[model samples]
Target: MFPLVFLTVIALDQLTKHLVRGGMALGESIPAEGFLRLVHIQNTGAAFGILDDARPWLIAVSSIALVIIIWLAISRRIGFLDNIWGRLTLGFIAGGTLGNLIDRAYYGYVTDFLKAGIWPAFNIADASMVIGMTILVFLYLRSEYPRSQ
Candidate 1:
C-alpha cells in the first residue's frame, strides 16, 4: 500500500506538471469557474515562494528529508507505521518530496499550477506533502497524549 500510494502520487504530480509545461505558456492562467484557475509557473523555493533564491539549499534539504522518510518507512520503528494512516503519511510525504526534488534537480525549479483565489500557485506534490504532514501531526498528538475517559 505504501509503495502504491507513493508511486501514484509521484506519477500524478509528474504527469500534471508535464501537461502544464507542454500545454501552457509560462505565467499563463486559465480560469476554471468560480475562484479556481490553472496556471503555469515555476517556483524556485519552498511553499508560498519562500527562499526563492535558495535552490541548492532547498534541494539538499529535500533530499535529506526523503532519505529519512524512506528510512522510517522501511524501519517501521514508529509505532504508528503499523496502521494504514501511518503508511499513507509516509508514502504521500516521500512521494511529494521526491516529486519536487526531481524538478529542482532537473530544472532548478518546480512546475506549479492549480491556483485558487488569492493563494499562490502550487502543484500536486505540495498538496500531498501538506496532507501527509497534517495527518502525521494528528497521529503524533493522539499517540502522545491519549484522551482520558
Candidate 2:
C-alpha cells in the first residue's frame, strides 16, 4: 500500500509537471473557470519561494529528509506502514519529496503550476506534502493526547 500510494503520487505528479512544462511557457497563465488557472513557473527555494539562493543546501536537506523517511520505513521506527493513515502520510511525504527532488536534481528548480486565487502557485508534490503533513499531525495529536471525556 505504501509503495502503491507513493508510486501513484510520484507518477501523477511527474506526469502533471511534464505536461505543464511541455504545453506552457514560463510565466504563462491560462485561465480556467473561476479563480483557477494553469501556470508555468519554477521555484528554486523552499515553499513560497523562500531561500531563493540556496539551491545546494536545499538539495542536501531534501536528500536527508528522503533518507530519514526511508530509514524509518525500513526500521519500523514509526510503524507508519502498519496504519492506514500512517501509510497515507508516509506515501504523501515520500512521493512529494521524490517528485520535487527529481526536479531539483535535474533542473536546479522545481516546476510549479495549478494556481488558484491569491495563493502561491504550487505543483502536485507540494499539495501531497501538505496533505501528508496535515494527516501526520492530526494522527499524532490524536494518539498522544486523547481528548478529555
Candidate 3:
C-alpha cells in the first residue's frame, strides 16, 4: 500500500515536472489569471525559498530524512501510517520528499513551477508536503482530544 501510493504520487509529480520542463522555458510565466500562474523555477534549498544555494547539504539532509521516514514507516514505528489518515500522510510525505530528492540528486535543484501571487512558486511535491503536514497536525489534534469519550 505504501509503495503503491508512493509510486503513484511520485509518478504524478514527475509527469507534471516533465510537462513543465518540456513546455516552459526558465523564468517563463504562463498566466493562469487572478493570482495563479505556471512559472518555471528551480530551488536548491528548502521550503519558501530558504537556503536557496545550498545544494549539497540540502540533498544530503533530505536523503537522510527520506531514509529515516521510510525506515519508520516500514517498521510501523511511525504510528501515523497505521490508520487511513496516517497512511495517506505517509504516502504524501514519501512521494513529495522523493520527488524533490530526485531533482536534487539529478539536477542539483528542485523544479518548481506552480505560482501564486501571495505564495512562493512551488511544485506538486510542495503541495503534497504541505498536505501531509496538515494531515499530521489534524491527527495530532484529534488524538489529543478523543471524540465523544
Best by lDDT: 1
Q: In candidate 1, what are the lDDT values of residues 46-94, reduced to their tens digit?
A: 8999998798899989999999999998888988665889999999999
- Write the candidate numbers in order of decreasing TM-score: 1, 2, 3
Mark the regions of model 1 whose C-alpha exceeds 4 Å error after superposition. Answer: 32-34, 145-149
RMSD of each: 2.5, 2.8, 2.9
TM-scores for all predictions: 0.93, 0.90, 0.89
User: lDDT score of model 3?
Assistant: 0.83
Scanning candidate 2 in windows of ten residues, the lowest lDDT window is 73-82
In the range 1-149, model 2's lDDT, one tens digit per residue, is 67887999999999999999999999999974458889999998889999996888988998999888766655656642447777778889989999999999899899999888888899999999999899888877777334542
Each model's backbone clash number: 0, 0, 1
> What is residue 122's positional error in candidate 3, in angstroms?
0.4
TM-score of 3: 0.89
Preferred candidate (lDDT higher): 2 or 3: 2
Positional deviation of residue 133's Cα in model 1 after best superposition, in angstroms: 0.8
Best by TM-score: 1
lDDT of each: 0.91, 0.86, 0.83
Write the number of the candidate with greater lDDT, choosing between 1 and 3.
1
Ranking the candidates on lDDT from highest down gives 1, 2, 3
